[model samples]
Target: MSASRDTRSQDIIDRVEAAGLRIPAWQAVCSVLETLGEVLPYGTAAYLASSLPDSMGAEVGRHFPADSSASQVDRGDFVAAVARRCGCGVEEAERAVHAVTDAIAATVPFGVMVNVEHVTPEPLLDLITR
Candidate 1:
């Protein structure tokens, strides 16, 4: 990644930590991106990633669908997956999710996040928005 992009990626981790996720900031940010891979539609994932800093955008794009498909997951499943990835409980996972998503919201363009909102389910929708 370019120097500026690397700096921006670090900034995202910093924001996540500032938002109170207890885990290492990079891990928390990565966990949230992986969870998004499970939940988001292919096009939406690609679009979302495009708006991120280079490292994060590439990380998220790793799951971008060749087949234009995504795994079926609800809010509970999303949190559970994040918990598993982070080796934490549901509540901590939620905090990580919130912290990372908040960071993403602040970092990415508003329109990109709105696309994510439109594709996300109801209870899970609250996670990104909150």
Candidate 2:
């Protein structure tokens, strides 16, 4: 890996570890992102990370806030909303949801790290392998 990627990876690993999530869990999250990034556009992984919910839920209703006027919807709601705004069909929206959920499952234990640079796959995998 390039020096920059190595540095970025280390930074992500440190941030995740500092948030107290288990290494294995973080690894799993990174693995999913890496796979998704390969299949999607360059920024898709970052976009997914930005849209994840703060907690887990079986459905959008369960995770979204009770108030419709809230600035921050549940992470799940935010992602689904984004998909709708993008004009994606049901299956595409579901895929986006899954990508966001997978990311959240990886990071919640650690804490939310919003820095896209930190989680990009080249750096993320380097961090994981080390």
Q: Best TM-score goes to which candidate?
A: 1
Residues 27-77, candidate 2: write the lDDT tens digits.
433433433333333343334434443111112223222223222224344
The lDDT per prediction is: 0.80, 0.38
Q: What is the lDDT of candidate 1?
A: 0.80
Predicted candidate 1 versus true structure: per-residue lDDT over 4-122, tens digit per residue: 77877887888887876668888888878977865688788888887888667776776556533333456787899899989899999998888898998888788998899988866
- List all candidate RMSDs to the true structure: 2.0, 15.3
Model 2 residue 6 lDDT? 50
Q: Model 2: residues >4 Å from true position, as ranges?
A: 31-130
The TM-score between candidate 2 and the true structure equals: 0.28
